[model samples]
Target: MSAPVCTIDATGIHVPSYDDVLAYFQTEFRGIYGSDVYLGNDSQDGQWVAILALAHYDSCTMAAAVYNSYSPTTGQGAGLSSNVKINGIARAIPTHSTVDLTIIGQAGTVISTGIATDGTHRWFLPSTVTIPPGGEIIVTASAEDAGAVEADPGTITTIGTPTRGWQTVTNVLAATAGAPVESDADLRRRQKVSTALPSLTVLEGIAGAVATIEGVTRYAPYENDTNVTDGDGVPPHSIAMVVEGGDAQAIAVAIASKKTPGAYTYGTTAEVVTDRYGLDHTIRFFRPTAKRVKVEISLTALTGYTSGIGTEIQTAVAQWLSELAIGEDVRYFRIAVPANLDNGADSKTYTLTDMQIAFNGDPLGYVDLTIAFNEAAFADPADITLVVT
Candidate 1:
């Protein structure tokens, strides 16, 4: 049977519905063969066959349309970049010189390598590192065999020159985790949310523009119209933004691109932003100062609690806290959320009798922790000290 015509959704993208395709086949079969096509019943072999074929065709058409809806110019399309972390030691090299490192994957495979300066010590892999689901690969590093005369992994191979402060480097951290190619569903959702702004001169427009910047995961923009003068950076007609994770310079440029000409900016970092018109504008934007929170929890593990339960609980709490938006408070009761520790077989429940939030090793003596407008809360698995008694 011929495929049904594609229809456009409210987002102006063409999509085909399963029901529409099924109905079209039913009608076409009845008209051509002059016999009833019973689509609703399972016993009709001919009708079922036609329905399956039409459904596949409709799905392919919808997928193609969704793929074509986004591009780099639209600000909603996903661009190329992946996050990776590289860790190793600089051995016997001069204090201020640069060193080259190679990343080796499983079975002595050379995955990728990059150069790094001495001080920062850590480098992110330039290429995307894909670790299979539920599996991890052993990654090691070796000093660049050539280039940069003084830098070498040393003769011992395993044991480097300890006298010159050279140690074996073997750890990798994903600086910014690389995203896979955007799926169709994810692209469609982004398109729907990226509605045309009224004007690229308003507060929302400024925020929308900033959101499009790569590496920016979360951001919030606020305007202060109050007459009172406080140190909070929000003055009348001034815009203050709290942004998390991105190229700071790109964010500054985006702010300059969208904000009203006369509007004032208030925040920590200020940079000269050059717009597309070749004019330079100085813009100040706030990067969220991460305030580390220490979570102390007392839990009585039930049936699902295994020896590794403590690690699991710590991971769960850290993941939940990381997902919180900037300026959002950390609720005390969320610590008790059920954690699935037993794979998928059993649901684990715990009783959190006592929980505390500590800052700088001092307990806040409260359940809810409020973060400042300019700050974001960060919690790491190491910071979560879990005691199960």
Candidate 2:
């Protein structure tokens, strides 16, 4: 009597079905116990055969999982993390949001434990900040709570821990949004991009090198190879790199290492890199301007509907917007996909009647929104409005 076996070949791993395994077991039992032996549903032997079949099916599934673990594309969790190591990258951990805060006070004043708030979340200053002769100091503040905590300009007006000479605190610009734990989909995408580090084209190599930098969450590189500057404002024979997160010096070094010798680097942030030859070179890159997106979703509630489900839909839409790549346009229908995903059965509780999107301060419409090459679309869950009837 032969047992059911999973096959692995050039095509892929082929698993045996439970029914196939059961039939094989039944045939073998008949071959041993005699041709006329009864193996009905009520018989003890029948029950034993069903259990054995299920066990064999589980074994086959485990084998398939093992095979998939060897490849980054099919692996998950720890297996995926291990495979990405070959590309010199790792899973990105959660990061805290940062903002540049203006602290005004008398000259020579020193603050040891400074904290600011935007009414909801707390942002912490460095261990100490001394007001320069200018009577005010601009310092970067990290959000006390990690992950996408946003504060608009001038919103952080409250000084949580007031010092004797510290008069007021406020943020000059919007907070640079933080990110949650990197998802498997994002990791795989980065892994693929990293493989271009040694590609034939210089542009691909530059993009690949920048993508692997530590703390760098998302990046896009554009090249203007022609004689004149491109429409995106990249100089001729130069590259413009738009990166969301990373150390300035590390980004400059990565760009300098992979960029063409005479080609220009363009953007707002500039870091000076000294070559081994003792020559100083300036590398420039852009920090993307986050354009907050507004989402309006109208749906009809069905059975099992709840306000919690509506919140889930809003989160799903916001997350989808956040994941769009630099310069990627926001499509009108794309917003519907995430909202209707099977998020713990919440998606089934409502039927979408209409969906619309717009940039901050713009009227919401059912039209695709264009994103500039140097800008990225950001959506806060609070900005996602759901109308459920």
Candidate 3:
């Protein structure tokens, strides 16, 4: 037996009906404002009005719109009837950052609808709306409010209903952010913020590289300059990953202090740089191409010891170094016996924030460093905490 005509199409498949198309569109815009509405104006004052603000109306259900009028004679005559009709009532969205809505077709047919806000933004429109049946209006499109801090801008959600005679105006307010839009104003704002050298995308790269100090640098615009540039030092430019126990200010300060000390340069190609996160670094090379290069990092002088540069800070630098050693076979910074300092006198507890490490050839340079004692180091230390790797 053959399938029914309504259920069969080209190769014998169920063909959807026009109602199905309407249903699909409706589902797409469900819950969104202006998702349901008709086209046209049912106004009195012979003027076109916006119908973008309506309740219980979806964009898929709108059709044509019209307006009606009533006239009476001076003394003895009855009344006369007439009406106006408008064809298309569609909105035009801007290309890049702006958006706009207009009333074409029957002039004076559309009325200004009231305005509303979605907590975060505001929206505007004609007095009321008159969406016709079998037509589709726009729901919400991107608008051009530009960096609203709290509010980005708004997009048109729904047009209101327009009825015959004088229709009550309602729901018309400005939007904070709009959709399906392009506004020169918005573009200009973005361009201004994006003018910095590293630009916007660099912020992301910096964030990914510096896991410990992202919030302090990325969340605040004040330090944007710090993250994008390579500070003057041995390692040239490197993203800092400064971390604090929790506070952002202390982290920022520590970063500045570390940079001030500057790095010791062994040679032009190899130099040292401490990360803003207080990770004292001996960055000898970068984007390495050599298959293997003999490298050694030392931290004997770091643990709890004061130098011509820094103060005694570490309670146990060895513990910190062991955790960072990825390979385990060949790992991090530790407290090494000094070349001259003897065990009794040298046994003095000092922070070995960095120790010596060795590796060769691979682009993935190995970092074997000692425990870093920063900020609260002086106040947070304990006496006999030994560092053993």
Candidate-wise lDDT, in order: 0.54, 0.86, 0.28
Writing each residue's lDDT as its tens digit, candidate 1 over 1-389 gives 55666555666456566666766667676787677645555567566756675767767675654555343223232321111001111111111212122223233323233333323233333333333232233222222332212222221123221222222333222222223344444333333323423455488777766765544555778887677645565777789887764555677877887778788898765656776788878788776655677888777867766657677778887767765778888787665562333334433455556777756467655568777787666667888887787
TM-score of 1: 0.54
Candidate topping TM-score? 2
Separate clash counts for every candidate: 5, 0, 106
Per-residue lDDT of 223 in model 2: 86
Q: Against the true structure, candidate 2 has what lDDT? A: 0.86
A best-first ranking of the candidates according to their TM-score comes to 2, 1, 3
TM-score to native of every candidate shown: 0.54, 0.84, 0.14
Residue 347's lDDT within candidate 3 is 48
- Give per-residue lDDT, candidate 3, residue 114: 36
lDDT of each residue in 1-389, candidate 2, tens digit only = 56778898998899988889989988988888887877778989898888888888999999999999889899999999999999899998898887767889999999996899999999888888888787876666788987877888789999999898899998756777787788898899999999999999998898999888756777898988899978888888888999877656678899999987788999976667899999989898887778889998889999999898888888888888988999999998878788896545777788999888899899989899999998889887898998878
Which residue runs of candidate 3 sit more than 4 Å off their true CA positions? 1-114, 126-130, 139-389
